[model samples]
Target: MSSARENNPPAKTGAARKARPLKTRTYGLFRWLHVYISMFSLLIVLFFSVTGITLNHPDWVFGNVETRQEYSGTLPEGWKTGNQVNWLKVVEHVRATHNVKGSVADDGYQSDEQQASVAFHGPGYAADVFIEMGTGKYTVNVDAQGAVAVMNDLHKGRDTSPLWKWVIDLSAGFLTLVSLTGLGLLIFLKKIRPAGLITAAAGGVLVLLLMRLAS
Candidate 1:
């Protein structure tokens, strides 16, 4: 009986076989998630990466031409009430007359100088209005930065709308998901796991070294 058991090995047990199928299914699910999520986020990743390069080297000129326009106008006297400047009327008038597109970033009145300044900011765009509180005479200066500047601002979520901020957050979540699933898939590949982990560690160390050098 001992010789027969040694020769046959009693055929592999069901419990061990079941464990393999569960592991394989889990691995397959993670792989599927990794592939699809990566595909969906590819464009977003490319945009951010390219913008990152542009951001890091601001002096790397992309011929970003800034065009400035100056216009002189007179505002209605009713736009101001006593010592206070009516900001709402001023902004509306600027938007209607000059076709300005941006949110008001600053609105201040200098009582001594009898002047008021209103500034608007948007992605790669700025508009400033200086007004003589008494005469209502105003000067508008509008600056439009080139396309590259706009894209960079969008990537950084600088002066962007809340909707765009949401997009950045969602993209970050997707990237996190992709990374975790990718690491999970590597665990199932025994032969490559050691090399993969080493490579990942090396990448992390390189980033840390670069940050240290930068500081």
Candidate 2:
């Protein structure tokens, strides 16, 4: 019986070796994904993290210097034929003359009073134009809140273009993938898994406690 058991030990060891390859392959794939995704999202992660700090402490990031510019001009006479105001022409003319940077956010016309107002919005910048319909007189006010404010707005996706919003979405997805794969890799590390999970749990609990305390 002892001789038979010793011979069977080789068979058991071979089976274990076969199982090991599958586990190793899965771990390798996860590590690969974690490394590459983290690489791709590194800059995006840094930007959002830094901007998050700046956002939380706005006074530290930006000074109180806001720039305001005012311009008065006359719109094309043909814009108001009767009671109708050609808003497209007005927008185009204003954009061309003043070098406006953003898309038109609102165009409000008070037909009863023959008054038109248009607002343009972008990251940390706004422009408002008020026009008198029949007389073609218009006033433009542009407000710019500087570069730090622009970066903060970009982080929040405020007044940003659709393409930038897509970039934010993609960055978020990649970051999620990176985090999951990193956690998966930790599971394979026998010596470190317990400590890593405990640390993660502690960090999460700390955040929850902070939130609860604030509330």
Candidate 3:
């Protein structure tokens, strides 16, 4: 039995199998691919990541954003000083004077308050104009510039040209590919990549939480 065992090939143990050297070429290829993809998308990645951080800590990043915009425009023809106001002339006048890239449509009228309102959605923002028919004064409130708002609006292709939207969609697809390749490389080196599992689990949880919250 001893002679037969000696002649037979030794069974490979886990340690022996693990001790086998990693393929340098395969490792190099993965690293090269990762580096190239990261370099190609560096700017977009940086922008999105920074914006993410900023969004997470909004108070620190956006405490000083503008909140209101008020402009006085003289009423044009068919508009009255004290009589009931016309919304079409107001919208056209505001677009001409203040560069409002939106159409003004009738929102509603309040009988008790004797007021009329119009709504406008622009490239980066939306505004509702409320005019106190009795006072002949208008008040406009604008939202704070937020990272999520900016990112989401970009994702929705709001007011963007068709070509720009296409670019964003293509870049998003490339980002997914890069991320997947990185995860695969990580799986191959999990044993030596200290804290790799922990880091990956944490990242997965974070993504899930963020997506849930966003949805």
Regions of candidate 2 where Cα sits further than 4 Å from its true position: 1-20, 61-64, 106-114
Worst 10 residues of 1 by lDDT: 104-113
Per-residue error for 80 in candidate 2, Å, reads: 2.9
Displacement of residue 109 (Cα, Å) in model 3 is 11
Task: Pick the winner on TM-score between candidates 1 and 2.
Answer: 2
Q: Report the number of the highest-lDDT candidate.
A: 1
Cα displacement (angstroms), candidate 2, residue 13, comes to 22
lDDT of 1 by residue, 1-215 (tens): 99998888866777766455788899999999999999999999889888888888877668578999998899876787886888888889989999998776433323435788888888889888999877889999999998778888999998778899999999999989999999999989999999999999999999999999999
Cα displacement (angstroms), candidate 1, residue 76, comes to: 2.3
Tens digits of per-residue lDDT for model 2 on 1-215?
89998877655456566455778999999999999999989999889888898899888745536799999999976776677778788888999999977876554334446677888889999998888876889999999997778889999999999999998999899989998999999999999999999999999999999999999
For candidate 3, lDDT tens digit of each residue in 22-137?
Answer: 67666777778888988998887676666566556646744334455665544456644446566557767667776655434334333235766666754456666666666656
Q: Candidate 1 — which residues are off by over 4 angstroms? A: 1-20, 106-113
Please, what is the whole-model Cα lDDT of each candidate in the order they appear? 0.86, 0.85, 0.64
How good is model 1 by TM-score?
A: 0.84
Residue 144's lDDT in candidate 3: 36
- What is the lDDT for 116 in model 3? 62
> Which structure among the candidates has the greatest TM-score?
2
